[model samples]
Target: MTVYITNAKRTPVGVKDGIFSTIEAAHLAAPVIKTLADCSAVPPDEVILGNVTGPGGNIARLSALLAGLPQSVPGFTVDRQCSSGLEAIRLGAALVASGEAQHVIAGGCESSSTSLRPEKAVFSPQSIGDPEMGIAAEWLAEREEISRKDQDDYAVLSYRRFAESIAAARFTHEIVPVGGCSVDEAALKKRPIERMAPRAKSAFQPGGTVTALNASAFNDAACAVFMTSVEAPGMKVIASAASGADPNFPAASPVPAIEKLLMKTGLSVSDIDVWEINEAFAVKIIYTARKLGIPFEKINPDGGGLALGHPYGASGAMLVLRLFYGMQQRNERFGIAAVGSAGGIGVAMLFERV
Candidate 1:
C-alpha cells in the first residue's frame, strides 16, 4: 500500500512572542488539522503530531479534540526534535501500509514563545556537551570551510526569494489565516535583505559566522497533512528512510538519512528533481547539498526556514508542503524532503509528482 497526501496546510511562521504567543500549542494546531480534513473530504482515523517544546501530555489528542474530530479518533505525539514533523508523517504512512489506518493526519506544532525551554543536556548521552543549534552550525561551517560571507549570502537569498513570493501572494493557497496574522512574521518582510543581512549580530559565540540573521528564528507555528492509502492528484510518496549519527554533530545527519532512502529505493542523487533540505541554519543546507553533490540552484527555490522561521517541529512538514507547491509550479517529477534532528538523526522521503 502507498500512502498519499491528499491535503496539506501550514500556519504562517510566527516570531517568538509575536503573532501566536497567546495561543497554546494544541490550539495552534486545531485550525490547521481541522482544515486539512475539511479540504481532504476524508476524516482522519488518527492524528499524529510532533512537538518539542509544548507542555507535556498528548498534544495530538488535544489538538484532534479541539479540531472537532470524532471522539473515537485516537491521536498521539512524537518527539524527534527538528525531524518530529516528518517523523510523524513516516509513522502515519507505516500505519496505512500496515493496515492500521485508512486515513491519517500527521504533522507537527510548536508554540515556542509560550512553551518552556527544552533541556539540551538530555538530547544526547553525556560524552559530547550540549551545544546550541547555532553553535553547532558554526562548527560545521568552520569544519566544512563554508565562510561567513557564504552563509550570509545564502541567508539574504532566502529572504529575497520569500519576499518575491509574498509580493505575488504565492503562499495564499497553503497558509491558514489565524489571529488575523496572514503575513509571515519572521521573514524580514519590511526590511531590505541586503541592508539587514550583514548587520545582524552573532548570537552564539563571539566572532562566529552564524548570526541571528543567518540562523532560523526560533518560532511558533503548526502544520498538518491528510494522508491516505488511496492515490492523490499531484504527489505521492515513493520512498522514506531514517538514520542516526553522533549526537554532537546533528547538522551532518541529513546526508546519511537521504542516502539511506536513495539506497533503499536504488535511486541516485541525479534522479531527484527538487531537494527540500531544511535550512535549520544556512550551514545545514550548504553542507548537505555540497555533500550530496546537488547544485544550489535545484535546492530551496522558494526559500526555507531562514527566511521564515524554524518552528522546531513544524519545519519538516513545512518543507514537504513547500516541495509540493514547488514541484507543482515547475511541472517537476521527483523530489525529496529531508531534515536533521537534534539527536544526530536524519529523516528523508522521496516523492513523485502524480
Candidate 2:
C-alpha cells in the first residue's frame, strides 16, 4: 500500500503581473502535467490538482484535457489555500496506496493574473477578525518578537542560496519549459538583497518586520508530480498529516503540524535529513524551526519561498519538488515538507529517498 513519485516538474514561477500574466491558469499547469505524463510513459489513472486562483471550473480537468490526456482520465481539483499542492499530492498518493489506482498525476497550479478574486479570501468566523495573510504574518512577528533584522537576514540568505543554485543550474532538472520561458521570474528579479531587503517597506504593518523581501511574492506558476504504485527513481511517500491552530496566528500552524507528522511516523525532528517548510514569511520559517529546535542548515538548505515566488496554490509542491532535488544532491536519507495555510491549518508530509 505504499506510493512512490516517479516524475515531477514545474513551470517557472512567474511574477503576478509579469511575463505569465496573460496565460490561463489551466495553461500554466497543463504543460507540466503533459510532460510528466508523457515522460513517465504510463496512462495516469487520475489527474488531481490544487488550485486557488482561477475561474470556478475544475482546473485539474481543464488542464488534463489541454494536456491531451484522454477523456477517460478523471480529474479532481482541491483547494487548501497555500497547502493545496501538497494536498493534491497527498490525495493522489492515498488513491494509489488504497488500490484504487496504479498511476496518478498530481500537483497544483495558479495564475493570480487570471483569477478575479484571489485577494478576497475568507476564513472561519472563529478566526480573530479573519485578518488578511500579510496582516496575520505581521501580527505573528510582533507577538513572537521576530526582528526586522532577523527577517531581512533570512531573506538575504535565501536570495544568496537561490542565486548560487541558479549559477549552478541546479533547478534545470525539475523545470519544464513553457512557451520558451525557462527562467524563474523571481530569479530574474534577484538583486543585492542585503541592500534591498532591509529597505523594503513592511507588507502589513507601518514599521513591522514583514517586509516584501521578508515575505513571499504573489506570483503565477504550476508544479506537478507523478505518483505510482510501481517503484521508480524517486522518493517513497512515507506519511502525510495536517493540523489546526489559532487562525489569527496562522503562520505558526506548521509547528504543531510537524510535531504531529513526526509523532505519527515515529520519528524525531533530529531524524529528518532535510526540512522543507514553506517560507510564507521569514517569521513562519523562523518560528517553526525554532519551535522544532531544528538547525538552519538542515532546513531549506538550498532556498525557499522567500527567494522563490509563492504561487499560493502551487507553492507547497514547489517545496516538495525542491526537497526531491535536494535529497539527491545532499544524499539526504529522510525529508519533510510542511506548509502553513490560510485559516490556521498546516499540512506536513514525510519522504524517504528511493
**lDDT of all the models against the reference?**
0.87, 0.89
lDDT of 2 by residue, 1-354 (tens): 889987789999998888898998899999999999888776799999899877878999999999999999989999998999999999999999999999999999999887888466677684366888888998888898888888888888888888989989999989988878999988877488888986898778787778888998888999989899998878999999999999888899998889999989999989999999898799998888788899988888878888888898898888889878889888888999999988989999999999
> What local lDDT does model 2 show for residue 81?
89
The alpha-carbon lDDT assigned to residue 129 of candidate 1 equals 55
Candidate 1: which stretches are off by over 4 Å? Answer: 118-121
**lDDT by residue for model 1 over 145-179, one digit each (tens)?**
99988989988888888787777777889998888
TM-score of 1: 0.97
Query: Residue 304's C-alpha lDDT in candidate 1?
Result: 86
Q: lDDT for model 1, on a 0 to 1 scale?
A: 0.87
RMSD of each: 1.4, 1.1
Model 1, residue 281: what's the lDDT? 89
Clashing pairs in 1: none
Clashing pairs in 2: none
Give the TM-score of each candidate.
0.97, 0.98
